[model samples]
Each structure stands twice: as C-alpha cells, then as structure tokens.
Target: MRHFNHLLQRLRKIVAVALLSATTAALAGIAPAHADWLKAESERFIVYSDGNEGKLREFVQELEGFDRLLRLRMGLTVEEAPPRKLPIYLVGSRRGLLQVSPDLAENIAGFYMATDEDIFGIALRDQTVNTLKHEYAHHFMMQNFAYPYPGWFVEGFAEYYATVEIEKSRILVGKYNQNRAYWLQAASWMPMTELLSKRPLQTARNRDSYYPLAWLLTHWFVGDPDRQKLLSAYLRDVGEGGDPVEAMQRATGLSPTELSRTLRRYMRGPMPYQIMTLSFPQPPVTVTRLPRSANDLLLLNQRLKVGVPDDRRPATAEEVRRAAARHPDDPLALLALGHAELHFGDAAAAEAPLQRLLAMEPDHVEALQYLVRARMEAARDAESPEEAERLENEARALLHRAYRADDANYATLLLIAENRAGGAGSPNDNDVTVLEQAFTLAPQLGSARINLAQVLMFKDRNAEAIALLEPLVNDPHRPSSGAREMLLRAKGMSEAEADAEEAEILRQGEAEDEADGEEPPTGN
Candidate 1:
C-alpha cells in the first residue's frame, strides 16, 4: 500500500508538470503554427513578414497603441490579449477592387475591410494602418463600455477622425460615403427633439443626407456656436449628470424627438448660411509607399520561433537587452523586449522599450496605448495610485490627439458617445439620440441595429425588432451568420418548432456530412 501511494504521487507530479508546460506554451503563443513571422526593419514600422505581414503588424500595433492611450486616459487598465492576427494581401495588379469581405470592397491602392473571429482583414497598405485604428476603436469600445451610444455622434465622430491626411490626399478611413453631399443639399435644419428619436434604418436609407447632417451637427457641437459652452453643456448633460435630451431642449429650445423632425425638415440644404468653413493646406508630396522590411532584425525572430525550447526565447533580461541592442532602430524588436519585460510584470522595464518605440514614431498609437498601460500597471505595482492617475491623464490626452488627428472615425466617436450615455448615470433621451447617429454611420453593422432594435423592444416594440429583422433574414448575403440566427430566433418560434426544423436540417446535414465525411457546426 505504501508503494502504491508512492506510485500515485509520482503520477500526480508528472501530470502537474505536463499541465504547467502546456499552459506556458499556450501563453507564449507557441500553438499557432503561423503566428511566427520573418522579422525585418523599415523606417515607418518594424517590418514582420509572413508575406505582407508588415501591414497587418502595423495595424495591430496602431490599434494596441490606441487602446493603451484610451485606458491611460480613462484610468481603466483592463487586461487584454494581443489582438488576433489580421492578414493583409498586396495586389500585384489591380484586378478591379479586391473583395476583402462580403460587405467591404477596396482597390489595390485603397483598402478593404473584413473581420473573422478577432482577426480583421485589410487589403491595402496605406489604408491598413487607418482601418486598423478605426476597427480597434470599435473593438475596445464594445469590450469596455456598459451601454451603446447614439448614431449621429458615433458615425459623425468616426467620419471626422477617419479622414487621414497622407501627403496631399485625404484618405477616407471609413467608407467613401459619397452620400454625405446629399444631406448637405437637403433643406434647412431640424429641431433636436425629432433628430434624436429617428430610427437607424430610416436614417441609413437616407444616408447621403444623414451622413452630412450628422457631420454638420457634430461640427456644430465640436466646432460651432459657443464651442466650449455648447460642449461643456452637452458633455455635462450626457457625460456627467445632465439629461441629453433635456440639455438639448434647454440649449436649442427643442426636445430630442422634436430636434429629429427639425433636422429632417432642415435636411434639404445650405442651413440658411455657412455655419463654418473647415480649410487646410494640402501636403506637398503624396505619400508614395508604406514600406515593410527587416532582414537583419528578423534573424532573432526566426530563431525564437524554430529553436529548441531551452535554446529559444531570450532567457534573461540581458539577452533581451543584447538582442534589442543589435537591432537598435527596430521598433518591433524593442517592443518585443518591452513585452518580455512586461510579461515578467516589471513596469519599469516594459516602459523603457515602449518609450523607445514612441520616440521613433510619435503617432505610433499601439505603443502609446500599451506604454500608458504599462506605466500605469507599473505604478500600480509600485503601489502609487497618484502616479497611475497621472499616467491615465497622459493616456487620455494621447487618445484625444489621435481623435483630433481625424474626427471622422465613426468607431471612436461611437465609443465616446456610448460612454457618455452610460457614464451619465441615468436613463434619459441622450442615449437614444446617440444611438440614432451610430445607426446611420454603420447601417450594415448588425450590432448597432440590434442596439436600436433592443431599445425599441424594451419599450414594448417587439413588432419593431421583428420589422427590423424581417428584411435582414432574406438578405441572402448578411455579413454575419450569427446576426442572421439571432434574427430567426427572435421571430417568436417555439423551441419544439425550432427543434423540429433544426432536426430536419440536421438530418439532411448529417447525410451530407457523412457523404462528405464532415461534421456540422453546433451553433452555440
């Protein structure tokens, strides 16, 4: 019996070791066969290649930076995983526009957009960075915020920021949205009350008019009237403690719903007179190429990937220090060193390399964001709340800089607007107003539509949700299967009925799967 107990103990010890090994491997990202890329060096960004990997890596980096900045700004440092790897493909020849996804289209020079799991796809080199920035904003907001924001503010802000000034050209970071002109051509202004209460679908169908109106309206808040006063009042009402709708009523002499109607009526044109003129000098040169290369720097990266377990990975801070020394100018290598130090839970070590990356690229959003987080994380580790708060302020300031860089990034705007809705601490008309704006910007985005539908449904508007879902079910080309399924499930079908239908489909699918030797998906 003593011998038997000894054997059992030995088995348990072996199992524990194996489990620990597995966990470590997983955390180190060793399981993904394609995660490793050939490292290279370039001026704009440290190039990593799995063939066109630079674009995706830069995208991820910028996104990471944006998030870190926001967290630093907001004083909320939630742990997050590295963003899923997004693959970018370069077109040797323009075969029309590459169909990046079901919903997005892009030319070789412009960019294409699509998402799978956490992996986002960008087709163009130039647009990849901006698109990543925009999408990451969406991902961060959805993950962190408690509630959804309004449509106008969401899309308007996205549009404002999505405009990228590259060389002499304005690259639209969001959609081209040619329709903004139509809204500009629409009649005079609407009351705030009516505008806030408008439905998303209704707004989308008139997006040409809606987009511009939203831009103008947002411009009004951000640029027009007594800019500071209007913003202070509006933000206070929505972000602090005032009612958004009531604030509008007080400020503009119209209720939120009434403002919606007035905007519609005012949608025709000119807004009586030019409220503001946004003018700027163009860049002297067109940004020719967003380059990607790093042969010498990547040698370490390749070794890290394929070398034996003990032989691979920098074993000490000194090794990381040495490797980073060899590739002094490579941001990725520096970031890797920083990431390694951060992994050891040393904020100071992490901050050093991250700050190095920032010095090279001031607008490096990902580094800025993560550096902020690391700084705060380090401060927190050092048990200094005041330092963390200062770091938070710096981070938020960085986001504002990114935000100010381009105001058209609807996704970022949506994040802020949504925050305002929930952060205001009360249910009022502002939430509805903001959501309506978001609906216009991303009409095809199911999440925003769902937000609208849910609000209506909560107000006992099941018919409205059904109404919204009905057109989408037959879309045949819905971007998300999940969204479609939700629509079907929301159609008031009994479980037994759905089960019966599913069983028939499953039986058919099984026969098909058997013939093909493939299994069907279990929809969760």
Candidate 2:
C-alpha cells in the first residue's frame, strides 16, 4: 500500500513527494453499503465477493490456477508461496464495475493499485475478465520481472496473457483477446512506424487500437516457431542495449512496413492458443461470511482503499463516518473511518476512531499506523516547538509499536525511514539499513527505492544508487524526474547538468503523457 497512500501524503509535507507513477483512473467516488459478503482466502489471495458462494469458491480456484499457469511457464515451481496474499474485491457484476467507476473509460473492466509491499484490485466477478487479468499481469511483471523491457513488449506481453482461459484440469493461453475485437476491425490503426518505433506515439484517441494491435503482434511472434526464436532474440538484443526498432530488424530481417502487412494478413486469419494439462490443481480455500453488523463498513473500507477523487472525497468521507458510528466498537470499522479522515485532510478527526480501535486492540498494527500519521500531521501544525516535539515523539513510539507488531511490514519500515531521516542531519547506518530492508520487501515501491537511492548517493555509494535507479528510470509507468536526477548524480554528472537534463526529460514526458493519456516514462 506504500504506507496506504494516506500516510505518504502526510510525509509529503516533510520530504519530497515524488511518487514513481500516477495513472488517472475512471473511478471518481463511492457511496457505501455492503451486504451478502463472502471472503475466499487462499495462500496467495484474499478475495471478497458478494456473489453466490459456490461461484465465488470456483473463482478463487480459477485464480489460483492462473497463478500456477503463470509460474509454470516462467520456470518457477507451482507450489512455492507468493510474496503476499493479494486482496481482490470482485464486485458482483458489470453494473458493479461501473458502480465503483461510474465514469470508467471505454472497454475498461477493472483496475489494480500496487505499493511496494501490497497490491489489490477491484473488478466485476461475473463479467469481462480481460482487463482484470491484464492488470494482474502487470502486477506479476512488476513483482518478478521489473526489468527494463521495451515499452511495447511490456503492454504486449500483458495483453498476450490477459486472455488466459482457466479450466478445472487444464489452461489455455495466447488466445486473441476478444475484448479488442470491436476495435481491431473498426478503429483507426496507428502507422507502422509509430507501432515499431521506441518512442510513444502522441495521440490519446488514436491509442484505442494500441491494445488489440500489441496483442496481435505478440501473438504473431508466439505462434510461429521461428518467429518465437526471433522474438526471444529481439528481447536479448534489447537487454544487451540494442535500439528496439533496430533490434527488431536485426532479429527478424524485416522492415516495419513489411512486418505491418504481414500482421494485417495474420489478423484476418484464425488466432492461436496453447492448451496445457494442469500440473497444479486448485489450492485450498477458507470461506467466511462477514457479520451482518459489519456489512456497510466492509464496502466502505474497500472504497477508501481504492481512493476517491478530491471533488468527491467529502461525500465519501461522510459516508465512512456514518458507517463507523453504526459500529463504534468495531476495530475494522474504526480503521476505515480513520483512513477516510486522513484522506479527507482531517487528521484530528481521525483520532477518535483510531483511539477507540487502539483501546480495544492495543497492538492493532493499522490502528497504530493511523495514529502515527495523525500525530505527525498534528505536529506539523503545532503552535509551538515543544508541542511539535512532543507529538513527534508520540508518533515515533507508535511507529515502534507498529514495527514490533509486524516488523516486516513495509509501511512501518518506510515510516521508520522517514522519521529517522526527515531532520537536518544525514541518515545514520541504521536509517540506511531500514530503507534498504523496505526496498527489498517492496522493490516495486517507487518511494522506498527513491529514498534508498538518495541515502546511497549521500554516502557516495553512487554505483549502488545507479543500480537502484536504473529500473525506475526505465519503467514506463514510473516516470520520475527525481530518478533521472539521481541517475545523473550516480553517473557523476554535475549538479547544473543534472538539473538541465531533468528539465528536458520532464518537458518531453509531459508532451507524451498529455497525448497518450499515460504516466510518462523516465527519459534519457
């Protein structure tokens, strides 16, 4: 959760708030009231659904099957445990997806939010699953292969896997994503040069064809035996520092124009998919029905977790308050209410519920976290130095308590790193160690990585800083001027030169981002 997002905002007042990525969502806000709740807990997932119990159980098994399919193909053992149990909220139906994201973009069915230590997704259970799988594929890549894969293959690979068909005893993969069928035939396709070039094409509306086309190209390479080898070779060359377009030509011996024609012909023909017998059966699952009293708060908790746009926050926050009041003694309810309060920019208001939660469960990890955030924020606004220091000390103690309860929690480690290093002096070795540990726990978390890189740079460990910033700079989803600046420092550039380079990168990325409706990538 990267400090559950809300805590990070509090840190923004003290330190630089340079997140690695920020993608716009179709969702605007939420109004909460949930009943008929069921939870399906597996080793790698905790899914909440308000659908039929039998159907929900089957969905859980299918998801486990998909995880196995991914691992098996990637040369990993199927039985190994995942890093953490991902929480998924499979809302009831298509109407439910829209319920969460009323202004959802055309064809988008779901979304996922990832922090360094945790990730969660919201989608409609009994509806189109292509986008759900697509989002999970992105998560899988970020967790395992956070490599500097070319921008096209990043989307292409996920698109290729998005249509996976999970069955009881087997799985089907590489199927053409029918979700894009409408666009493939009717939408305006991008130029061959635009498709093949490493630079992102600058057009938001025209990007509609991007998904289907990327899927087609990936499918083409995967279906042909020789082309598959060529694709692997293309990846190898890119990994070894070849230009993506040039590497494509070197590996396949085809011009972009010729390749585009070949793809157009290929698109008109039947698609290809591979069927494999499942070597891994479904994992065990525990199902639980949430208490009736906790119903409304349950959904409210999920809505807050996903977030609400500022324009809609007040309304959603009020709903959260009302829901918690209905269950004053409920710790989970208090936690959600506290989260809503923090996000609504009323840290003081968050205290009551959080205090209630702590009084009941003194060691409640999340409650301790909310209190830390609230107190620090209060300190930030204190009337005098004495009050500020007192509040800060109290916040620090709560942070330590949170660590003792779950030391491995990335959020706690991150909070510890911030508290230790936020002052005038440079961070000591303990601070560096804590930041490094947080990075290890959530390599995909942008802030922790950036914080650790800064510490290393401060210590003149430029090589370590460079290695850490490389993937971040190369990740398309994570366009950070801070990362580029750090990379420049790590590479021994002058301060003036780094600043100049960062400005140039931002100028370029902003243009592409505006046109393509995506978070800009780190630029050279």
Candidate 3:
C-alpha cells in the first residue's frame, strides 16, 4: 500500500503539472513581517501569498507579462482571458509548499492541478520563478493546443519558454536552461535515434538527459527559421501516428547520426535568445489583505482546498473541523470544513457548515453549490421515496437561488445541469443549454466537456459529441479521461480501435436491454 501510494504521488508529479526544482541557496523569504495573506486579482490569475505586497505585485506583473508573451507567440489578437482564472498559492517556502501536497517529492518545488471541479497552482517562492513558469507553460499548452504531441516535444516546448526574463526594455525567450547544466555535462548523450524515437524515458541516465536534450532540440528548431516550418510538418505527422524518428529525418533531410552531429556543433558556441521588444500591457491588479477573521485560517484552508494525499485527508479533516469550531463565524473556516466533509464522504456532515456559511453569506456561490451537492447526494441515498423527492426538491430550489446569485458561476451552472441529468427522463433542452454554458465557461475542466458530450450523444448529436471527444482523446496530458470510451460509444471511431473493456461494457448494456424486452439504442 505504501509503495502504491508512493507511485501514485510520482504519477501525480507528472500529471499534476508539478515543477521539479534543483538545489539553491535559501533566499530571503517572500513573506511579510505581519501574519497576513494577500489576495491579488488580475485578468488571468488570482494569486494568494503570505508575502511582501510589493514583491507579490511584481510577481503578478511578471505573470501577466508571461501570459502576454505566450499570446503574442500564438498570434492571439484578442486580449480576452481564458475561460477560468487560475488560483495560485505562492507558499513562502519549500516547507510551506509541502503542506499543500504532503506526499509530493521533496525536490518538486511547485505544482498545479486541473481537477474536474477546479484548477489551481501552488509553488514555493524562495527559488526563481522558472519552476512555476514551466508548469504554467504546460497549462497554457493544454488550454490552446491539445493534439497528441510526442512527450519529448511537450516537455521541450515548455522548457524552451521556461527560462524567461521580464526586463524593463524587453522579454527574453529561448534562454538556456541553466538548471540541468550539470546533468547535460555529466550524463552520456542519448543517440539521436533513441532521443527522437522514444516518448519520455525514466531510466536514471535518460532522466538526467531528457529535459536538457529536449530543450536543446527545441532550441535548434526555434533558432532556424526554415527548420521551424519543417518542424511543424513533422509534428503534424507525429500527431497522426507517423514514426517520430522517420518524420524528423524526412523533415530535416538528415539521418539520425548526422542530425545528432549537427545539434552538438550548433551548441558549441553561445546559444542565441529571441528578444521580443513588444510592449507588455499591465493589467490592473487588486490586492486585498485578508482580515484577521480569515487571515488565521488561510493556510489551513488553502492546504485542504488545494489538495492532499488521501491517507492524510482524515487528519486534515479533523484539523479543519477544529478550526471551524474555533472560528464558528468565519466563512473561510466553515467553507474549508464543509469541503473536507463533502470530499471525504459523509455528505450529511457537510450540510451543517455549508448551511452555516450560506446563512452568513447567503449569496456565496461556493457555499450554495456545496449545499446543493450535499442535498443531491443525500437524495441519491435516501431510503424512502418521499425523502428522496423532498431532498431533490430542496436541491432544485437551492440551484435556482444559486442561479439568481450568480448565473455566470460555471460550477453553479454545472451543478444545475447535473441535478437534472440523472433522472429517469432524458435531458431537456434547458439542461443542454446549461451544460453548454458550463462547458463554455470552463472547457479546461474535463468534467464539463465530458458531461456535455454525454448529453450530446444522448440527443443523437453524434457529430458534435465526436468533435468534442476527438481532441479530448488526443490530449497528450490526459488522454485517458474516458474520451476514447466516449468516442467508441458514439461510433466516432471504429470498434477495432476501442478498448476491449469499453466494448464489453457496451455489449453488456445491449444484452441487458434485450433481456428487458427493449430495443437497444443505436450509435452512429
């Protein structure tokens, strides 16, 4: 069990957009002298930090600058933000970060999680900002382009932009990755064939070489204008299942050994950086210091709300409960306690604090949503039909109230749709509209996309559902989020391509339908 949990944490490091940090001398902490937390809001991010206000403001400007740089690179003309704002917790130290993700590796300085419910990033502020920037680069990639990129290219692309310098005059990109310089010097070079053909390797030597080599390869492409065009074509082919090594050789007109030789020589001299002199628009940043009512509970709330290992959650829940008890009037404390209860089961226990929070702040979107979930889950498990109906009715009432409070709240809209999706009847047009709105609000949330697809297929809108499932199945970071199974069910792809277990589940459903003397629905 311990080994399995360790493996799970390692898996989380990769999938959670976790940032691995090298050793560094301890710099002065970002925390302010006072025991207070600052919440900074900008166009793209909502950052919480127990740090100097000036430093945190500068930090946010750098973040905004990076966002703009990425947009400029992609030629995104509109300055409109992505669907949802990413909440980032700039934990003041490495130890502070560990409180957010206890089982995560010690060297992992930062991480972000995009769960079905929400998205957030957490990082230690002691090191340079490269770690968070690299992880955010991955998030940016996930948001914009989600083709089945080869693992090497995915990491490489992030690495290329990882070492950023937001200067007064200009922004510098394509800078060298000084973090892995030691690994690059010490580790044996991976042959071009091995480098180009494989996804990502975990062997000690391969691990040492992977990031540096990938960054070098990516830099080589970025530096040469003509090669950039060829690289695009090569990636397209690889996305369509072409052999990476073969495609690379075809694109560059060089054999594996020759290409390797050229890359080595290309790095012999000091590498060039692409400096963009574009004006970075400074978005308005609002920083609010938390009142003592909430300030004392911020870290504990963040630790619980961000995430924790399953084994530690029970203990965490106990702590939250105690905190809530102490600060009975504090909304943050109550919200955290309620979240822990709902997340760890005992939906009944979740209702008290959530209800308490709602009574204090009646229009609180999160509290309303939590209360609705508790009621809905209780309805599901209600032994008596009368109790079930009563619970569901109350849930619907709360959803209506929640909608009135904030129609733009995606979680509220999603909950509204889900509240009706599990009935004996099929989804109505209204439910479909709600789901679509939720999807538009947070296409980054896998659940929103999946829920909409499920409803689309049910409505025999197979084409639309397939359109959604294809990119989902092709997503390099999270390919196995039931998208392929969904595609198979919609007949988006062939039965031969579908997983055997998925096929069996469908066959079982058909068999059950036949036994029940009903015609099984057909897929397109």
Highest lDDT: which candidate? Answer: 3
RMSD of 2: 15.8
Candidate 1 Cα outliers beyond 4 Å, as residue runs = 1-65, 68-119, 127-132, 164-195, 203-205, 222-247, 251-524
lDDT computed for candidate 1: 0.45
Greater-lDDT candidate between 1 and 2: 2
Reference-based lDDT, each prediction? 0.45, 0.72, 0.73
Q: Per-residue lDDT tens digits of candidate 2, residues 319-370?
A: 8788777875766778888889987747678888888888889889888887
Task: Estimate, for each residue in 1-524, the C-alpha lDDT of model 1 and write its tens digit.
Answer: 99999999999999999999999988866432222334333222233334455454444344444444445433575234322222333322333122222222343243423211112223344434544444444444433442324445544554544433232222222233344645454433322332332122332222334446665565455434475376456644543324445566666665444444454455443332221122223112111222122322333322222222433233533455666776665676776567556543354677777878878877665455455455444544555668756755665575565456544333433443433433444234566555555554444445566666665555566655654543333231232345445555566666577456534433533343334332332332
List the candidate numbers ranked by TM-score, top first: 2, 3, 1
RMSD of 3: 17.5
TM-score preference between candidates 1 and 3, better one: 3
Residues 11-77 of candidate 3 have per-residue lDDT tens digits of 9888555333321212223332234778999989999888889989889988988888888786775
Model 3 stretches with alpha carbons more than 4 Å out = 1-35, 188-208, 238-246, 255-258, 293-296, 306-310, 424-436, 452-524
TM-score of each: 0.34, 0.79, 0.77
Q: How many backbone clashes does every candidate have?
A: 65, 0, 0
